[model samples]
Target: MSKYLDCYDYAAIHAQAEHVVKHRKKLRRDVVQKYLDWFDTHCATSKLRFQQAQEVIPGGIEHNLANNHPFPISIDRAEGAYLYDEDGNRYYDLLMAGGPTILGNNYFGKECAQFIIDKAPLTGLYSEYERKLAELVCQYYPSVEMFRMLGSGTEADMIGVRLARAFTKKKEIIRIRGGYHGWSDQFIYNASEAPEDAACLNGIPVECFQSTHCVEPNDIEALEQQFIENEKFGGTAAFVMEAIGQDSGAVPLTREYHAAARELCKKYGALLIFDEVVTAFRLGMGGAQAEFGSKPDLTIFGKIIGGGYPCAGGVGGRREIMEMLAAGINKNRDKKVRVGGTLSANPLTAYAGCLTIEELAKTNAHETLAKASDYFMKEIAGLTEKYDVPALVFNHQSILHIDVAGSQHIPTIYKKDDPEFARQSKEASQCVMEFAMALAAEGTIISGGGKTYLSCATAPLVDEILGSYERVFKGFE
Candidate 1:
């Protein structure tokens, strides 16, 4: 059993979520503008850089998560728990490089550089470090009998679904609504803020989502129904979800739900796929499956798997399912799921991943990270109470959610043509963005205004982190 199992209080999390849903709140428009002005005045360098970037990069950002209200702050350097912007302004980095740097930024830079110096990153051939990384993963995650590296979380998820279909000879995949399993065409269905299935298919074809189905998080009944429905064409290939819940516990899951879902997959003959991109290492060394005591048939990993480096994604599972990815030239080709990436599990990333897992084990860093998250949750609760702000703050270990606007709690199923629901979602999203801008101006970085991924390095900055939240809460209407 993992020591971090007691790190979460699901009862408290659900109660707080209900309370916040009943009393949604956000900062006043004037207060939001006040912070936006801070960016315009204080972030001259970043503004200039963003303007220059817009000329080359569409929307002046590479990752969708980097888009801020005013403009994305240009990060010049990142040390432990803090990001130094090009304007010389320092901010507490609660984003944690979008859920990768668990030991914190640049924690083992010298070691990674030394490994790269020795191994030169890639050789278009297998590296010993890849096997070492796979061994470490299999050692910690009991569900992962064998591991296969890939290019990104999207690629990993793509292959996971494909492998499930090949292994089970099934077609459809069932995903929890609003759970991001990467931007792949099949998984992108039902991802919009609205409940309707057609809202997000701007570029992707409608037929791509035909084999994909959605269920509200923790709705075991709905999940089982989807599996039954998929039997018309083919049995559900996989039930994929973020184990904690969609958007890193924006809609949290219950332990009962986890246990039931696991059983349903067994009954329905569907592979259970946990997208542990954010929760794998940050939750604990054994990942959320171990923490919850519910084992998944296949697990999707990203972020910390490469130790905060690029090309960080993979799929691991029972040896039989994983062996379908074996490298061969048209040998049992019909039964194989083909996947390839020149840079996947290259020397540097694989070596760094091994080092990260070793360091995490050596120092027992996840427990420290959980403590820091617990502290953040407490401070946030205090601030919200003191200001009479109805906000939900919860965590699954170090993965934190601060839903001041309560956008995430909005119902997953709603009328397709309901203008009122659309308006509410738009307002909530905009307000969330503005709220994040306020926090940024106050020198704290959070993801999409509500989620904050913390690390072991966050322990020392707990007070400072809360100070930023307090300032933002104080500006509430």
Candidate 2:
């Protein structure tokens, strides 16, 4: 439906995925050992700090991305395209603070810090900046005539799902298999590539997944079948997915697929929800929905929404559906979604979010990011070829996905209960983690060794990063 996505070659991406799965590759054991040795030698202070942190902090990390092998590198400071570790080693940042720093780290921190100094962080009440942030979101996201801010992406997803159920008066929620909405109980049903496998349900009860259904990405027939199957029960509430596939486009989806999904939702009387947590402003000011030319009934926002600040999540959509989250007394309390957060829409995050969006529009950051990513992706293709590796690299604008070992697609390749599945999955995961370590050792950082969230500020580092990838590739087995 939209030519904006012509830049992405889905056929090439799928071929890459196939190649990696059929012939999985990883860093050589000696090469991986060398990378580990480098971490032990160069990141002495970071190792010490993480060891100290283990006494109190679980896994010596607050974020999952920080859980790296040989202990995570403790960052002392971040500026532009680099992360300065406590050990004084500076690495080029391609993670972009886990996909929030679109304009780069601390781009608008000064203004936001000044705002915090003037107005404080929280007031436990209304703030004009909250209205301003919501207005900014609504202005860009055409599907969102109204918006409601939340504390994090998880919270936003929780409420978005609730709003869908409330609006449709249904009990079932359908999500793409392997798609992650959040850590919320209902939404985390199928968090892996395995269809209907609630593998992450440690503390979550089995009944929490009753109303959730999983469908593989790009399977329009499977999706429509699930909706039809739901009709025998309570009918479908919503069909939610990461527009570009799971793990932020680790498996890419096409515009034709998205358009079909949109129509199916309408035909089945279910709302189409786009989980744009990582893609929101990164895809464009208007988001993935705008680029795809398909309007979702509700859109979830996070990460860049708060401009890399806290309280960075929201759900926005058509007025009638969003109005279900309205505050104040209501006689129809049972009909409305009950949502609340003490720190949501606080002064600090709100002002920063507003400034970030304004800057995104003013600076034309997307154009810069697009050009930079084009260069980066081109180089990655060359590196993969030169290394004689089965890896694949592709991008949805600035959100670049480099499938080193095809770990993200493992569940799709192997049955979850297969005897070889566990072994293959573990090996693939290790390969990915090791690859990420190799990149970090080469003065580059990415998300779990697979995903890279580039920013306008990181555009200048394209050549440097290409070199970094080549160095890492040289160490591959």
Candidate 3:
């Protein structure tokens, strides 16, 4: 039998579900009430302040992702791997601003932030920092010959599709199922379960996805079949996808699959685009393409490049295609793509991005961060085994996924005939949610969607985090 099954059976035999419930009961209501009361007396003040702000700020939070259950923790400050909540609650932060802040918050160098604050945020003109950042990015990703900066990953993905259409003179684009390129109209299809048949977000015209196609990851036959059918309908422009499935929980594409994809794109007369917004510097200095040894026609990047700041994204690749931006090919005569934003390549964002990349390169921070992530995965696995819990941890460098009740061991994508496997997988995802809620109450803020990230984390932080997991899991015992 497979090693996964062996591990599962061993855990099943030793598992005591009551241990988890009994410990949970020990920390139940009364115990939680005492802390809640104390928090109310101390922490409720900030909660009130944020609630008042909500009248003007829509959700009382700048980013929807920051708003969490029990109301969001109004963070007073953060340093390294820790966040200081308004109530003086210090907790380990695993979300890391949804996978940015590789060097952690407030570490983007005081000098850089100060310079931007004094000089200005946006100049609406070309700045030296933009050129410097582009140069740095090109040094690492040689495929990016001529690149254009944008405001967010969403914008980059949108513009990337436009560029592909402009270059290839084709309309249709292919995306993998469950891959989230962005909230844009063209590339938003098949992202989630929606009634729209195409999975396109509301407000998007149905025609936007008429040419877009969806394929399952790791399924070479299905991918080729889509290409064959798409060609009959006027050919495909590009195959855009996250090089390392970030939103889908770090589900890596096999080397053979990526290689096959590159060959297929060439065969179909379509451009290949790698959406590296979350995978960029996190996987390595060269990103997923470098790690996987596959070359694509275009690439999109964000997140770590911004160093936790806003307005970070860009598209880069073959000179012939990227130079189209300068060649007046965007169906506009002003020699500019119709897609320029007031804040695209803003001075402040550029400065932060440059400094962040410099730090990442100088210290080899990605390697260290990967080590911390490895430690985290191993410790979590060991803890699950020791506690006889059916939890599994999977990771790629700094990104991680927690699959409670054996979810990690199951294939997320399976053949249609494999109903038994699908049923088991669905149950495992449900179990993950339960364990995640419990972990959150214990003061560790992992992503609500069962994902986590590590940044500038040290060995000591790993030990502390694992200890917390051990304590929390022991309660399950």
Candidate 4:
């Protein structure tokens, strides 16, 4: 219920998280082994495919999402709400292609395929679809007065940070710890990896990371302190964060806190940048910013915006800030940042983005998907309680977080140096890996580390997915 918490009871959620982590060790060993044994028998074909792919693909997989524990399952094809693996097994698609495909696997597959074939995938120029897509984004999202497309969310982040620094003429960027804002160098500071390693910052040089300030979420005082500290150096360009907290709300933040942060940014002459790559079409057409009523000066988008197509991300915001990327508007447009890509706004992705956003808006998909997500969370939470499962089932909009390792989602700032955090992170990491493998064998595709996405088509499959989860949970003893 912290999802519905008015002011966000962080202590309550953190306490539950700690209890669950400690409890995970008590789960039956035989129950887990039983599922692993089942995987060996049922996933023979997938295992063979992985063995063959390792010769070509670096880790036998291309993307991090496919990084399963033993080996990832190779999907053959997908329909509305299900994925069919090469082993001739079908699994409920809880991942939703990592939070796109709101209308399902192939919302208008035939039409889109035919259109791309008739025209061209890349004509080396613009399409009406590009303008149409931008129009739809600007119309649905109040914050997006002007928009520009990029290849992926990572590219959008790189571009967005540059735009922010350029527009504000400030060098420092303050982001919340554990906020995953794509793999851009600036944002990689506190994203993806464990929070404790934020200081070392491997690969990225010190000068690069020194331009950004990282702070823990849910504490306005810490943010204010960071703001004060930045005054000693250059001013902050932006205070960028996910609409929800890190890991797609693994650590949720209160509405009041976000508003306060926005005010702090205003006080320090920094742009308030909300990375809406995951939340854009899911929380609302205008994204989480709209749902929470806390507007941002700039917004970054990915995944759902491209409608499960390639080149699926962008940045959009107020006219003044967005127009900074305008093409050839000024010979001295070097004053404005230049954002360009080979396939920046190609027709295929533009059409997919245009059609996807239009359908989501017209169908009010968020309302339906939210109900489905909440139902899954509520029922699964009860299922965990009844079966004594050591997992926490909760969600922010359609993105669910299942704490298989049971560690605190956002650990206290002080705990970074504690051995307690390391132990819990290791335990939860193992549990999550084994749990994902178990779910795959039980006929569900989930993100490896306790997170998965919901979509408009999730309503009908909830019971089947829940039933599978229940069966698997009981087996764990």
Candidate 5:
């Protein structure tokens, strides 16, 4: 087993599901009422704001992270580990801007903004910070020989896939279901465990996904089978996966699995692409690939890379593969595929990223955050045992996950191959939302699914954070 795999205790998680099976009704009644009453009283302004937003915004929220059960919290200001909503409610920002802002919200190199105030923001050209930031990242992630900044993580993955195809002169790419590599047209298609449900592929052309294939993580046989099938076309170009496993490591792939996966990709002449969007800085400076002991041909990064700013991600790897983006490298300059944004590598984002890494190194932020995260994960895991709740809390370093019935442990949570587990999983999902609202009521806001993206800034508030979750779980008993 991978040391990463040993980090969890699924037996305890699976054992707690019986409580959910036994007390579904009571949990629903109490948790729902508790959250509703609290939201009505405390988040009145947020509800009104969401209602108004619904008139214009498609989902009544800017992004899914801001969204909650009935509505989402509207942020007025944030500092360190806390966010203040429009309604004057304060929340412990567990989402941490969806796993970036490692040093905390509004942190852009501390003084970089002041320094850049006099300098031009963007010239649509090169800047010192661009080179400086690239140097900094290349120092931390030794696997990446060269790098290119992009508008978003999605953009990185889009180009990464294109680069893989161009480099190998191959077509098909294998991806893990329930894995996130950005929401590009190629990736959004059937990116879940339930291969039958292509609902997420609604607007994209079905033919666009003809070259993309899905396989569950840890299933080397299925992965190999996909590669075999792809050979009928042009052969596999790359195998892309979140190095920590799918759903941001909610379902972790074992050490042996990763080793086998690396071998499988090599056997079939496919590049191994590690999508480290969430795990880039959250799991440590080296990221999940280091933790899992797998080195891939390419690595995709986002979140903290740009230090919570626009144009905040990139693709990095071998010099030969990355050189495909180099224009002045050879006689045929135009042969290089275009793969950058107008604002990419701008001074401001680079300054932020440079300072972010500097701070992480100087203050030893990763170590502090990891220790607190250890406490938080184990504490939340103990909640199931302590209060007899049906949910399970597990994490990879600072990235947290709570599966209502620990269904993430059942091989694949994407399909209903096991009907009873599926039913309980759905119920537990509802339970998770309620608990999230409950946590919100107590001033801690996590993602809709209860992912607590912790930061070292929140280390001081661990006791209070734990108390908020403990109170909610005990309410169920």
Candidate 6:
């Protein structure tokens, strides 16, 4: 066992965290390594399981975020705000399935689950549940004159790009750097880089990023310049961005930047696409667009909309552009776009989504979750100050990012060569993992990454989480 494990008492944990700055290097290394070993031995089951997973599942995990230091925990089940791994260790779930499950796991009563089962899972045709859910979405988001369902956020964005090109008759796209819009080639360019000219990962063609220009999150001037040059380059089809940056450490664009970008998109005749796969309903009923008072030509939604089911995504916007997806206009001739999956709008997924929307709307779940998140951020901020750690807490309602180091300004979207920025990025990543591992050893889990999500967590649960933070921070002292 590591020395840190000897101090598992909550008071001792808090003392260690209070003096974290004094012993940063040792704590980061020992604490992180200890947790990694624990996860390998207790969480991953055995080397044989990992090997079997690798033989079947390419990367031994379905999603990259599920890959953790010692390998991801194979979750057994979840309820409320807690998850139980296959090893029977309980954890406070802060990952929240990467920002869905606003009502928490197993939120929907068996009635909702049974509803789907009784109605059958898939229809390979339109279902009343899909239509009702779309209408409910439009009820809150009036900007969506029409909506179409898809299998995942990736497909929603993929189809959005196609629609933008068809509507604008333009080829190029302008996306924000470090903003993750899904795995599709167009939006995947320049993601997860320094604040400079960083390229997308391998397997992606250089030509894919050639037409996809990237701009910084808050640089209004740079965005304007991109628009000006886009006109010279025969104009862009769409200016795509996460309404709030998700993968780039939850960085947000100021209201002024968004308004200016909206104007520039109008001036250049480029469609504005808000990739709200993670933001929609998570930020508010109408999402960041409604919260920030900005409107985009197209919006993509995922996560919370699906209600923790496998159901993933959809695109919604003005009728004119969305009409292209109608029977006659689309070239696919199957009364659908050339892009669609058999499970795109399955009845079970649609029922789950609709039920979730209904519950969320009835309980005003967003406001409650936001309050819980605000409490968490405030508590963490207090812990950081008390410990004299150079940490910052950032959140947009229910979603939160704990920057163990200070937040760095990502000036240009695609420029990734700045050494100082790189150093800060690495430190923040290390601090987050280390802190999270320490918390995990104390019997709490907050995603094991730099961020945390709040589900139907109540004030009592928030207090318990804060107590855990207090324990962790006190250890540093």
lDDT of 5: 0.76
Task: For candidate 1, give the lDDT.
Answer: 0.82
**Model 6 weakest lDDT span, ten residues long:** 1-10
Q: Top model by lDDT, which number?
A: 2
Task: Between candidates 2 and 4, name the one with more favorable TM-score.
Answer: 2
Tens digit of lDDT per residue, candidate 4, span 1-477?
112221255666676666666666433678777777876888888889999999998878988788886788888998888899888899888888777777888887887899878987788676798889889988878878998888888888888888888888888889987778876666777565635454546676757777878887788999999988988887888998988877677788887788898899999999998988888887778778887898899888997777998788898899998878857446766577887788888888888888888788788888888888888888887877777776656677788886656544626522766887777777667778878877887888888865688766667789888887877777654
What digit string (tens of lDDT, one per residue) describes model 3 on residues 249-361?
A: 34456667788899999999999999998888877889888888888999998766677788889888998887767532345555444567778888888888889889889
Candidate 1 regions with alpha-carbon error over 4 angstroms: 1-22, 192-196, 328-330, 412-419
lDDT (Cα atoms) of all candidates against the true structure: 0.82, 0.83, 0.71, 0.78, 0.76, 0.71
By lDDT, is 2 or 6 better? 2
TM-score of each: 0.94, 0.95, 0.84, 0.94, 0.91, 0.87
lDDT of 2 by residue, 1-477 (tens): 001123246666666565687777778788888888999999999999998999998778888778777678999999888899988999989988789899888888677778878777787889898899998898898899999989999998899888898899998989888888888888777776333544656787888888899888777899899999999887999999997788888777888789899889989999999999998988998888888898999999886788998777999999999988858568988767798898888888888888889989999999998998877887787778777777767778898877778777766667878977788778888888888888899998886746688887789878877888888888776
Clashing pairs in 3: 19-476, 19-477, 20-476, 20-477
Local error of candidate 2 at residue 471 (angstroms): 1.2
What would the per-residue lDDT of candidate 1 be over residues 161-247, giving only the tens digit for each residue? 999999999998998877788888888887744345667677877899888888877777888888889889878889998988877
Worst 10 residues of 1 by lDDT: 1-10
Q: Number of backbone collisions per candidate, in order?
A: 0, 0, 4, 1, 1, 24
Q: After superposition, how far is residue 152 of candidate 6 from its true place, in Å?
A: 0.5
Cα lDDT for residue 459, model 2? 93
The candidate that achieves the highest TM-score relative to the unseen native structure: 2
lDDT at position 58, candidate 2: 79
Instruction: Kindly list the per-residue Cα lDDT of model 6 for residues 218-321, writing each as its tens digit.
Output: 67888888888877778889998888664633555667777887998898899999988877887788888997798899999886667878867999999999
